[model samples]
Target: MLPTLRSLMRQRELALHLLTPEDALPAGALDAAIEWVHSSDLDDPTPFLSAGQVLLSTGTQFEAAPGAESVFAYVQRLRDVGVAGLGFGTEVVRAGTPDALLDACLQIGLPLFEVPYRTPFIAVARAASDMAAEERFARRSWSLGAQRAIAIAALRPDGLSASLEELSRQLGHWVALFNANGALDRVFPAGALAASQPAGPAAAAGADGLVDTVRREATRLLRRGQRASSTITAGGETLTLQTLGRREQLRGVLALGGSSELDQAGNEVVTAVIALAGLALEQNHSLDRARGQIRAAVLRALRHGDLALATSVSDGLWGELPAEPVRCAVVETRGGQLDAVTEHLEALVVEHPGRLFFAVDDGRLVLCLGEDGLPLLTELCSAFALRAGLSEPGAYSDLDRAMAQAEQALARAGDAVGVSEFGEIARDGVLSYLTTTDAGAIGRSVLQPLSEHDAAQHSELLRTLRLWLEQNGQLDATAQLLGVHRHTVRARIAQIEKLLGRDLSGFQERAELWAALLVAAE
Candidate 1:
């Protein structure tokens, strides 16, 4: 904290005297913070002075006996530039303090103090400079200490949430975190704020509105699908909202709220917290990827009839596997919503333990839940606007066949966002037969050219062809589902036909291509 004018006058060695009457002082004048002390003899020194500075002079710029109007003008100019106070050097260019100058300061509410000749202007400047330097040092030390505390908090078991709590504690303000779906994940000092109690600067502002506003901003940022930050005032307090993780894979949002604006030191502490939060989120993402791989491995074991291996791997980590007579469901999203949906599912899996199991396979989210958990599957699909294909309940040994059933059901859903059941569309037909191992190998060979082109050029030709087939060769529907122009869909289909050396317009060729797609999917 810088020394105010009242504090400066208390320095006995300087022999400073307050000329402004104690009773006549303006509001906050006694505690007016002085940023620095400067000396000048120029008539108009306001141009060189900044706000909150205390200007000292020897009265050299004034006439021998300046008039009241001239004195008032000088005082007004200083006040206009936000000078904290004026210090006149007595007995230097004059025998004593000028009456006109004193009168003008008193009338204009500008603080006026006297500087004795024994005290050089440099002495006042040095004192103010030393105080500012000490303040800077103290702030820097506090920032470093706060950053260390936040870092330590991030190492806790609940690292991400713990770091946020520490930041709120260090700043003496409220902090909240929101997941990518704009759902409130955690809040520090969780409750209503009371002004009389003084629970940090933002305590005066109600926490209810604070949280609502933060979540609203979080949603807006997520919808924008970009990495950015915004600051807003909620219930008379300032709140900062920042996006976490990369732009394409946003993890969540972090919000801090307080009545007063953060100083540079406080900002540095917040910046460190943001960085640590991001690191924790990225670490969790990596961990989630590893977990997904393990889940996928478990699923593969079940498909290969290795129940023992699957049970051993999943037993302690995710609870026991679902009992026999389990149903399989494969989910697919349009695009860009996969990360948010995956996060939601992860939370559910943690909350429910072994109630269900899930994994990411071939760009689709796959799940195996007990027959009783079927309602949850529907809820998930509806909530996330996803398309899902479900198979009838079967023993663990029949998982491979069940997967084909689910894939067939999903194919029946076409380009719509809803659930499709294998039992509803099952038939003893070519489609069902094509989903076998021998058929899959032939299908892969048939689409090998398109697959190679996609892998080498990083193109979406394969995806386009799949969607076109799903839409039953309808260009408009395929374009709408892919979020592209109809002409582009037509061109891709034309290119597919050329690569396959088959007329896509023919029913036999279309059926063959569709079967190949189903085989590859299984």
Candidate 2:
């Protein structure tokens, strides 16, 4: 450690005497490292001074007994510059320390020391400089050892977790790793530190809120493809967040909490850890991409009824196929870009491991997850403002049918239903399947008269008839739905019956009209 005010005062060789009482010393004065000792007689030496320095002066500027005002201004300036302490050389311009200067130092809580005539300011400067150099060298050695330890830990079975544990131990601080999606991958010290909570109520509640704020900001930075570092004081601790990656390819984030800022040596170790983490993340991404490709191939094989080839392709990727049948889900964004949604789904796959097989076909995401995974899929859909179609749980050999069902369901998605299941629409599967066949022709012929009449007269007769049919020919219900009187609804139905020359009393006619209406709506 660099020499501090307390240490310098205790050095018998220098014979420095502490004029400031222990209580008068500024907070952290005992541990505040002195970068160097600066001796100056200038009226305002703060401009040439920097923080963490012990400023020595001979009081020559106060030879004329500069009043309390000048003394207070000078001391305040030194404090503003963050000088570690102020040293006065006595027995030169005045016999002892000035009462005004001492009072000023006391008022500002700046540590004050009296330098004896026998001990020159140059001697003090040399001693501080030497100690600082030694401390730097020691810190460098310690940091190098830590780097080696971390490297070895990275090679262990636990890999990144081991390395992070070693780092946490070296820093005496908590460390956490967050993936690109802002999900925590691992943390050092395990559960000892909650990023969202402090250890006691003495800590501010706002500090706990910082965890989510910092995480969101970090995630935004990563999404923008930028390297970022953020520092925030929370729970009286300095929390630092660093992005891990090269250039614009951000792969992860490292969060550290400590009482003090990291020194140069600590920064070096963190840099090494960041590099290692980036490489690991890249490797994992490559492996995931490869696995996705294999899964895609397997899905294609299954679609073609090539069960043997599909099983062979998936053998190494998944331990066993789901015995209880699987549901196929087709998801697509309504208007947003699909990339973010795809990445989120991929993260879900990572979380669930072998429970899901996913592939991006064209601009849509295709997922074959276990039957119980429907809730997760639903949540993803809601989160991403996505439209999803789910097929019924079926055998591996039935993937082609399931995929067709999923596609049909997806086509049927609308404002009322953002996610539709195949079973929910299977009753109308015949009409849906004949979309390009006789359904279109039948719909046009059945509703052509009403459509032409409405177009010419600017009337809503067809709409009224559809509402009437939907309401089970209940004039009151149809009239209420249309916000019209029952007489108006009866008149529209009478016109519809006359135009189609079909009786409104038969179940078969009503069913046929309903089918035609369904085809027309599609």
TM-score of every model versus the real structure: 0.65, 0.76
* Tens digit per residue, CA lDDT, model 2, 1-522: 678877777778999988889777756776788888999999999889999988999999899899899999999999999998989999977788999999998999888889999999998988787777888999999999999999999999758788889999999888888877665566778753454365577345554465566577667666777888888876567778888877676778888877888988998998899888878878877876786677677778877888787766666656444444888888876543454566566667657655767776665678887866777788887776678888999987888788888987887665544678878777766667556345877887899999999999999988998889989999999999999999999888888899999998889998888888887776
Tens digit of per-residue lDDT, candidate 1, span 37-141: 989988889999999999999999875677889889999999999999999998898877889989999999999999999999999888878777888899999
Steric clashes per prediction: 0, 0
lDDT scores in order: 0.84, 0.80
Q: Judge candidate 1 against the unseen true structure and give its global Cα lDDT, from 0 to 1.
A: 0.84
> Would you list the clashing residue pairs of candidate 2?
none
